[model samples]
Target chain A: EAGVAQSPRYKIIEKRQSVAFWCNPISGHATLYWYQQILGQGPKLLIQFQNNGVVDDSQLPKDRFSAERLKGVDSTLKIQPAKLEDSAVYLCASSPTGRGALAKNIQYFGAGTRLSVL
Target chain B: SQQGEEDPQALSIQEGENATMNCSYKTSINNLQWYRQNSGRGLVHLILIRSNEREKHSGRLRVTLDTSKKSSSLLITASRAADTASYFCATDAARGSNYKLTFGKGTLLTVNP
Candidate 1:
């Protein structure tokens, strides 16, 4: 099976501008996730979706970031009025199962979109 | 907030040697997982060891979890140049009906051939 796919392997935008990244998760996967990894740091969960509805997005910055997984397959994350601090690699992942302790949470990740906010 | 914090921010070793990386978490977890991220690439799940599992082995990799101490370790036997990458430990903390993973800063391992 193919892995999670993300678009625009790299992106560059000026501060106060807007940028959007798209992701297409592996087929049959029920859960999708978006994460941000700043340089020298591990990826941080930005948002999570189980099918077409969001499971958790508490860590996301509501004022500037938003994401949606319509139809439960493809998802998009957008950042408006981007700041320099937003410069990081945006990673997309998917799991074969949904939420719960018994659910298998082995996530498969894409190459990620590196955003450079200048 | 980050739950897992890996020890020894960076390590450099020659091939054929054993590499050990340690991680410690703050809260109770259902499981802990290790992932490898190559330069400019996304993370790849290396292994997952449940809280009930004390130790697990997959090929040349061995993982040990100590819930009492809230710590875990990853050992790569006979390391190779291909093993050079950033290794991160993620703790799965189940909240109510939701499950999420909190990751650490990671350990940068460099293997010399």
Candidate 2:
């Protein structure tokens, strides 16, 4: 099985600029996640999608960050007017299912997009 | 809010030695998972221990979970330089679905050959 795939390994933008990242999860996966990782911090869940429907987005920084998963397959995360503080690695992860211990136990991740806001 | 904190934020040791890292969490959890990351890239799942299970081992990795103390530890025996990376402990909050993993800051381990 192929691992989760992400595009544009790196990106650089100015403050207030917009950026987007794409992710392709493993086949048959029904849950997708977007996370933000600061240089010295752990990944923080920005949004979670159970299939095409959103299961959680409580910490998405909705004013600028948004994500969507279509057809319950691929997902995209976008940050509009990104701030200097938004410079971090954006990671995408997927699980086999939203429920069940099998799915909860593991998450496959992508290489992530390293964003630099100048 | 972070669910856990890892001890010895960073460690250095020689190859063939054992490396152990500890984690402490705040809330009740259904399970605890450990993950490894290299160069701050994608994370790789290492192991998982259920709330009822006290210990588990995979390959050279050993994980112990203590629900009573709300803590867990990861031990790597006969580690190699390839084992050098950041280790994170994630907890699945009892209140939410199991996929809601709350990760700690992580412990960076350096294994020198």
Candidate 1 C-alpha lDDT tens digits along A1-118: 9999999999999999999999999998888999999999999999999999999999999999999999999999999989999999999998886455445578889999999999
Which segments of candidate 1 are over 4 A away from where they belong?
A98-103
What's the TM for model 1?
0.97
Judged by DockQ cut-offs, the docking class of candidate 1 is high
TM per candidate: 0.97, 0.97
Measured against the native two-chain assembly using Cα atoms, what DockQ does each of the candidate structures obtain, in the order listed?
Answer: 0.83, 0.73
**Candidate 2 lDDT by residue in tens digits, B1-113:** 99989987999999999999999999999889999999958999999888999999999999999899999999999999999999999988887663789899999999999
Give me the displacement of residue B58 in model 1, in angstroms: 0.3
RMSD, one per candidate, in order: 1.5, 1.3
Backbone clash total, candidate 2:
0
